[model samples]
Each structure stands twice: as C-alpha cells, then as structure tokens.
Target: MAAMLFGGLLASNPAEAATAVSSVTVTSVNSGDITASVEGKSELAEFGEAVRDEAPELAARSVSDLAVDYRVLKVDMKQVRAQFAPGVACVDGDGNSRAEDVIVAPRNAENIRYELSGDAQRDPNYDPAKQGNRCDPDLFWDEGASPEVDDDPAASAPVRPYTEKYASACFARKSQWKDIYGIYLEVSYNDSCWSDYVTKYDGNSSWNYYSVKAPSSCHIARGTYLTSCGHGVERNAAKGPVVKWDDWAPAADSNGDCRDKGISVSVGPLSVGGSYTHCEKQNIYKYAEDGKMSSYWKGKVTGTRATQHQVSVRVAQNAGRPRWTHWINSDACVCYK
Candidate 1:
C-alpha cells in the first residue's frame, strides 16, 4: 500500500464571499488488502463510478497487479476560513450569499493514462511484468459563500471579478528486471504526481479548465539485461517554458552490452528531440552484476500561442537480447484561453 497528499489555498476578499473548499484522497490497494475508512458524506460516492464510465481507457491503463480506488470529500468552509483566512465573510459577486459544492471533475486522466501505457507497449524493451497501477483523485469548487455589500463600489462597474478553476492528477509505475546470464530477475514500484485546483480571477467570468500533467516509465533491454529504466517529469506546468526531466540507465552485469542512452522531449506541433549520449560497452571481464548508469535532460516549451498544448518526454534505450534500440514516452496536456 502507498499514500500521497496534495493541497492548495486561495486568498479571500473582504468584500466578496469565500470560495468553497474540497479535497480528495487516493489509495492504491492490492487484492484483499486492508481498506481504509471512507470519510465525509457519501453523497458524492458515485464519483468513482463516474470516472470508470467516463474514462474507461484510463481505467484499463491503470491496471496492474494491484487495483486503484479513490474517495472524494466535501471540505468544511468554517475550517477553510479558520486555517487560511479568518474573519472574512463568504459571499458572491451578485451580492447574494453562496455556498461551496463539488462543481467540477478532474481533467486529462484518460489521455495521460492511455499515452503512458500505450507508449510503453510500443517500446521495444517493454516488459509486461514491470507494469504497475496509477490512481488519480479529482476535487474542486465553483461558487461559495460571500459577504453582502450594501454600498459596494464595484456594483456599478461594467465587469465583475470572476474566478476560473482547474485541477488534475497522474500516476505511473516504476519497474525493474534483469536476466543475468539466464538468471531472470524482476521488481515493481509505484510513483505519482498531482495538481490541486488552480484558481484564476481576472474580473471577467468564471469557467472550468481541466489540464493535467503526469510522469511515465521507461525501459532498457540488451545483452543479458532487460529492465525498467526509470523516467520522471520534475514539473507539470499548465503554462510556462520550464519543465525538468530525469532518465535512468539500465542495470547490467559485467557480461552486459548496453549503449546509446539518452532522453528527449516534445511539445505541441514540435518534433521529438533530446540529447543522445553514447555509452561504451563495459569491459565484459568486470564480474560485478549490479553496475548501473544514468542520464538527465531539461526541456522547455518556448511559446504559449496554442490554445492547448501537449508535452511529451521520451527515454531511449539500446539494449536487448538481439540488441535493439527503442524509446518510451510520458505525455501530458494543458489548455488555456
């Protein structure tokens, strides 16, 4: 079993209502594992079912030796105000009081999961036993309680301040395997990344934005070695030029033949590109069977002209029984107006 925590906060205005707050907790369980208590009201219990129906492809991709489950809970507004901003009354722009409700769903879980699994399957070094599960929880708020302003100065203003909300999550499995001169070896691990709700207020109108970014796994196969080469994305930005990446080398023994190790990245409308470094075959006489190597790359998307952009990272491996080279990729997307 594994656990992860994600949180965020938004400032409240004295003249307006405070936004409603919500949270989600994701847990991964193996067959017949001890189940955690499901907290909060069960009114939104159907959320999990909705996810399965709405994102069947994602559900399929998340499958592994273990199954994934999530629970969505409504947050207490009083607690939110006390913790983030005390003494602020909650109200809406229309001068009428408001309350928070779970108004939106998570974004991009299907596309991200599909790409991660599909890309790995397409890799020449892919290993079925190394695959793992992914779990993403979705929670966000739209309207919330606001203080009433009798003589509000902004009431006569042409446009009112409005806030737009967005949230997303993605998880990937990290696996490793080796065949040291006929001695097969294998191991599995899980990794995850997530973004809580992102709120943007521009004195306009409110709308829902669903953008999610997540990491994926990579593998290496060659000579007497066939194992998962870990891959990761350091940042999942909705809009920006800075994103970081990490790619690891395949584990090999003295008799192993590994070469051509590197990482690559691609953004919307851009071709796949990265630094490819050459790794000279280790001296076959070196008896150690636990030697490993690694490589790293940083990627940047220069422009923000596109309304929606997809970011992808690929790690290349040139090792297998027949010495074949292939690339595995992790993909994510962002949408803006």
Candidate 2:
C-alpha cells in the first residue's frame, strides 16, 4: 500500500547550506482500495517473462506483494529537452549505439552538472584537499552519499539536478497519482534500483543519431534492449527520487509498425500513453498477486523558488575522496529547476 507521507521538503536549491521547512499542498491523485486490474496483472506477468528472456537470473520468485500503478501524463519532450544539459547523438565503438548509458541522469543524460567543492565551504563536511574526481563518466561521491546508509544524513544524499535553465522541474510532486492503480515504489528507499542506476548510467552521453522510432510491430520484450525504432520518447520518471527502472520507455516496435504486439495500452486523445501500463518486475520488487495500484503527480512546474524543493548531493568520504576540493559553481548554476 502506498502510504501518504511527506516528500522531503528540501531547501530551495541543492547546494545551499541551510535547510528550511514549508507547508505546501503535495497530494496523491488516487488513494485507497487500489487494485491491479486483471489486464494490469497480465501486463506485469508478461513484463516478467520479457525480463526473464533478457536476464534469467531473476526468474519469478514467490512474491510477497505486487501491484502495478498507472499515471496519465502529457509528456512534452520539448520541455524535457529544455531542462537537461545538451547531448549529441552518436553511436558506440562496437557499432551499436548505446551512448545514453553514460549520462548521470537519463532524463538529462548529457552535460551533467552539480555544485562544485568550493561552493560547500561553509558546509561542516566540506574539505579543502581532496582527490580529483572528474564527471566525464560515472557519478562518484566523496563520502556520505547515501542518506539512509551514510553516517551523516545531513552531510549528503543521492542528488539529482535539473539544468539551470529548467529549475522548477518536479516541484508540486503529486504524493499520489489519482487515476492510476498500483503500489507506490518507495524508490528513494530502495537500494537495488538506485545502485543499478549508478552502475548502468553515468558513462558517456553520445549515441548514434538515428530514429529507431516505434517499429510497426512493437515487440514487448524485456532487458535493456533499446533500438532505433519509431520515434522514441525517453523519459526519466520522478528524476529526483531515484532512477526508476520501470520508468524506462519501451523499445521501438520491431515490426516497423506502431502497433503494440497484442498488448493493451492506455490511449490518450494526444496519443502519448504507455509507460503507465508496462512494469518490469525486477525494478519493482514488492509484488502482490492481487491488489490495486496508486499514482503520484505534481503539476504547474515553473523555474521559481515557490514552485520547487531543492535536493543537493555530496560524495561519501570513504570512496576515494577526502573532505573538500577547489571548484566553483557559476551564478547561473544555481536555480530551482
């Protein structure tokens, strides 16, 4: 069951030293009696099979709980493109284009940015002499990166940032997305997916520029097999919370046709609706054979202080990092987006 708890009311900006609290209306659209429709349940099962086809190690285990949630959203890729750093479309050395893997955050896979060490001078955990860690590939923390496991939660937490241009990204985080039926993935608390995000992504942000737009036959298979099929929609669900595995946009249809391979999809008037139905069992471990799913949504995001909650990230000291370093963030680098 998705409990209605407060999403972290963070500072207005990530790198800020002081943390403040404010009472705002952060609500979940749909509430109790959440049940996964038979169709929804079937979708989960099929996704499990697809995953098994890809990664067999995690075959179906006896599940204690499972529920698939849904969200009806109007995705504006142009808006998404505005928020993250710029990226280029290039293929890999193997002749396979999987370059988006290098991005720190899939939403904005290229041109990742964060607070420089010099900006944290006032921070109690800030240090002057530290190892030189580069952001060319892989996101590394000096110390105290994981809040739940870290010795000092105040010192740092898993940080996700939007570009300065698009500050007010996920401001009014909907505690529950009303229209959907599924369980709330406590993504921030989950250890497995969060770690997977760090390992798979954060490499190099270059991919071959080609439209693998949805193929005619959209084969719903498992595994991270993305292709240059139909024009694809790349989205990073709940970016700040965690790099959720379930939020991945399905691979382009293989048949060179936009038809889903006999799968039921929620069709909106605008034609953008699918992530709400598909769920990879691996990402969502809490499985319930029979139950309802709920949703979370926040709207009217703008690049402003009133509309945003800030999240900051720092390195864990133990991992090749001392205390501090020498670098500065541009004034433009600070914003609510």
Candidate 3:
C-alpha cells in the first residue's frame, strides 16, 4: 500500500515538527517514488484519535480501524481487546486548531459501494456483508492482512492505496512570540489516507527558498516534472503554496490529485530580505463557490491515487485517511527534482 511520495509539518495548539534541514539533502528524484529520512521525517507528523465507542466503535486491528459512513458501515474489524489511544501532537495550528483522523480503509481499498439509485452511487441495496461494515471483507492482507486490501468485498480485489495530498512542509515565519508557540517535531505518515495537518509556518515567515540549485535547477524543466499546462500554484487555503504537484508517486498519482493537476506555486518577484528576482507567474486559487463563506479546505481530488487503509493490527493505525490541509501566504518554497 506504499508506493512512494512524502510530506510533513504540523504546528499551532502547541503543535510543531520538521527536521532535516541540517545540511539539507532530501533527495529522491524517483527512488521508485520516494523515501527520505529523519525517521522518515518524524514518521510524517504522527497524530491519532479513535476511541469514540458510543457506537463509533473502534477496537482491534492495531494501527487503526473504523467505519460508519460508507453510506452506513463496512469498517468494523471487531477485535476488541483494547484500542484507540494515540494523540501525539494532534495536528494543531492554534486559535482554531484542526485535527480529526479516521482513515480506516481496507475492503476494496475504499470508496466503493455506490449504486443508490438516486444516481447509482453504489448502495443499490449494497450488501458486501451488512450495513455497519467498513471492512472485514473477510480479512486477507497478503495472507494475514496487508496485500494492500481486498480479501473479499465480493472479491472485487484491487487495492494499491496511497494518499498524501499536497502540503510538503517547510514553512518559515513566526518570529519570537516564543517561537510562535514553539513545539516543532512532527513528520507524519501513519499510512496516511486521511490527513490534514496545518502549521502554516514554523520557521518564522518571510522566506524565499529556491532549491535543486543545479541539476536541471527546479521550476518544472530539465527532466521535466512540469513547466507548462497550468504550470503550478493553486494553494490559497489561506493564501500560499497550493497544489505544486502530487498526482501521487512520481507525482505518484494514486488519485488524490492536487487541486486541479497542472499544479503551481513559485510566485516570486518575492522580495523581503531581497531575492527571487523574477519567476514569472504560475496560477491557481481564485475559488469563490461562495457557499456563503467557506473553509472548504481547498478542493479537487482527481482520479486514481487516493486509496489506502490496508495495514492494520494497530501501532498507530491511520492506514489511509491521507489528508494535508495547509495554509501559507508569501514566502513559501518546494522544489526537488
């Protein structure tokens, strides 16, 4: 369930994380997708939650497991010995902190079960087993449970799970206020299929990063990761770094497409301390669905890469609720090819 592609960072509500810049060298042009370290960047900003048994039952597996809205069930791996107890640094961002995870994807991988007649959304009396079923499809992860998913689900068999939609961490701006509530050290990835950790910027704002220095020298050129089509930049969740590129692994592309593909985010004439001479302008982010004000958390989930939750039996299970809700304004950077 892990092809490759990565991300990190979480701050606010006493939240914090991000480490590797000590000499900096997070290289992975395509180590078949990706793999960087610092304990894989704090295991990708680890965070957890799931002990809501008022019917939100979640007991066995290990890392994670829970389901109650695939229209109504399919994630109930009843092992009930004892579970749900992982709240590490919870995706804070203060003053309105945000953190909620429940990536229990396993049976058919996830997002199947639509035929409801109203539009054929699955549920045409969808009976993979019962109504309260999130996944127990009849367990068979490669043998014990982990081939990525599907031992049954009517044997629809097919799961390659991987979701980490945009937000490549490395925000800098918070300058003294006690490091803006300093707590830095989150590098997440508990299988990540349901992620949304925002710290905005923990390095203290006013940045102008530029990387790859020479090898093709970043900016969607050289070997080519993108430099045309929409070009890049659709990240205005709060005015900064939108969908730069993450169709999944080599751009991974498992489906959780960053905003509207054709990603961007290099905007610069950017001068603060001074530098960034010019970077033309790549765009995206003018959203105004106006549903009467919003916090839509930015939208756009293309096709093919957002399917996860197949390695359970707990250890901090978040198999794949791969979410990454971020925000930034001015002075943001991400370039690695």
Candidate 4:
C-alpha cells in the first residue's frame, strides 16, 4: 500500500522453468540422485505412497530415495532373520564342483562329517575333536593291557558316535532275525563287513569275508611307537600276500586314520590264518645249547625278518560266530609279552 506498485512473474517457457530450478541449489544427493522438496508437501511419505501405487513398476526403478517400491516398505524383519540364522557354505564331491545344488545324502554326510569332526569318547582310535578311526576294529587290545575308564571294560571299548541321519550309532547292521537289528564293523576297511550285519532275507545265504595277512617281520615291535596295524594275505610260494594298512601315525591302528591328508585301504588274497607260520624266536646266545630259549603262541609264523614278520590266526566258524584275527603291529600284540 505504501508504494501501490506490485508485479507477478510466472514461468512461461521451458528455459524459464530451468532457470528457476537452477536458482535453487541442491543441498544433498539422496539415494543415486539429487532430492528436492515438492511444493505444499509437509511430509514426503504421502507423495512416495501415491507414486508407488500409481506406477509400481516405475517406482521400483529407483531414482534417488524419493520414490521406492511398496515391497521395500513391507519387509518382514522376523522372516529375514530366520533365513540367515546359521551361516551356510558350499561343498562338492562326485568330482564336480559346478553342479546344481542338491540335497546331500544325509547318510554319507553323517559319516563324512563325523570323520571330519565328532566326539570319540574311548576306543584307542578315538580323538575327541578329530574323529577319524585311528585304530582298526579287528586290532583290539587286551583289556588288561590297554587303557580303561574307571576300570569299566565296556567303557574302554570305542564308543561309535550316534549318526544323526540314520538315527542310530554310526555303525549299524541288520540282524540274523529278519526284524532284529545289529551293529556293523569294518575290518578290511570295506562295506563288505556289513554283509554279515544286515538281516538275511533268505535262510541259505552264505557269508563272504575279507581278511588280511600278517606281516612276515614285526614292522611294529615293542620299541616301535610309530608303528600301526596292517594286513596282507600270506599265500603259497607262487602267491603273494594282500596288504592293506594305515601308515598314518595317529591312525596307524585298526580304526581308519581320518586326519591324514591322503589315506586309503586295499584288499587282496591275504589269508589271516596264513599270516602266522613257523614263528619261533630264540636268544640262543643267552642260553646254552642244551637249554634253547623259545617263545611261542597259538598260531603259525608265515615269515620273519630282523624287525618285521607275518603271523596267521585262525577264523573258526564255531558257536555260530565268525572268528577273525588281529593283524597287529608287534607292539600292539599282547600274545608275546
């Protein structure tokens, strides 16, 4: 009113609109682009909602944070938390690393996982953290000669971990009675050991076995702490022994040594009974000619050398039980001492 003069200017051309927009400097770049205040909008939430509802696909295409898909706003935190609870990693076997994701065979997974990590409570082959069977099952030691828990004979026996997949002990077998069950053990380091463990579907089924021959000389003697149990079959003059063993120190015994970088077992025509033959040792120098010192056990000594030898034990099919021999390192044998 004092000057009684007023003038109004409106944007009439694209150049004018651009000049007006340039006049207002952008304070910040939100999301991937600059964000500006919209006229007459107290809060940006309402405008964002309208844009998303009208052009959902377009809104999903981000242009700064000013516009976003309704899906983003509708995230369920609880669902997301459950999805990533335990971290996941990938592994491959079957000699293929780039195959499509498949549900791992739980049975094999349980064994492989336990072999990699499981609690081995007893059994000389046991390692609490590293659960490879360091000792062979057939190479058991005399209870009086080895370690025990509270003098409990049963406790000292190796405790096989319960397999999560099979819902039973890692070692399981079918029983004599079709419906009954039994535990399985691997002696020759093969699944054939399970043959006797599984229930027989037919009554006249025959039993097949895999056996190892004793060494000719004691590879593992009293003083040899690094020695482990091995197996080979002693054959006639023209035939050779079938050798299978674990050379890995921690698992050189009957139980498979799982920790060794590279370990394997082999089977051949080695007879357990053929291992021990003509096995006699005499410290003749210590005793006179009339009194010859000799050591003997109930078996044949097939072959012998200064520090290595092979002995044989009989596998009698008596008491309806299959008897097997312990092809052990001399240090692991209690028969001599």
Q: Would you estimate the TM-scores of all the predictions?
A: 0.23, 0.20, 0.15, 0.14
Better of 1 and 3 by lDDT: 1
Name the best candidate (by TM-score): 1
**Where does candidate 4 stray beyond 4 Å?**
1-206, 219-277, 281-337
Q: After superposition, how far is residue 121 of candidate 3 from its true place, in Å?
A: 26
Tens digit per residue, CA lDDT, model 1, 1-337: 2222211212234322233222222212101112122322222232222233223344444222112433222323233333233333322122221122221122223211111223233334333323221111112111111122211123454643332213333333222222323232322222232222211222222221111222222222122122232232222222222322222222222222223433232221122222222222211111111111111111112211001111232211111001111112221112121
lDDT of 2 at 136: 11
Model 3 per-residue lDDT tens digits across residues 1-337:
2121111122222211122111111112201110133322221222112212111222232222222211111121111100111111222233111111112222322212111111111223323222112111111110011123211122155443222112111111110011124432211111111112111111212321211100001111112122111101112223222222212111112223233222122212211111111122222222232100101111111111111111001011112212122221111011143
- Selected candidate, larger lDDT, 1 vs 2: 1
Candidate 3: 10-residue stretch with minimal lDDT: 212-221
- Model 2 score (lDDT): 0.18
lDDT of 2 by residue, 187-284 (tens): 10000011111111111222100010111111211112211111111122222221111211232211121222221111111111212222211011
Off by over 4 Å in 3: 1-168, 171-226, 229-277, 289-337
- In terms of lDDT, the poorest run of 10 residues in model 4 is 187-196
Query: What TM-score number comes out for model 3?
Result: 0.15
Could you give the candidate ranking by TM-score, starting with the highest?
1, 2, 3, 4
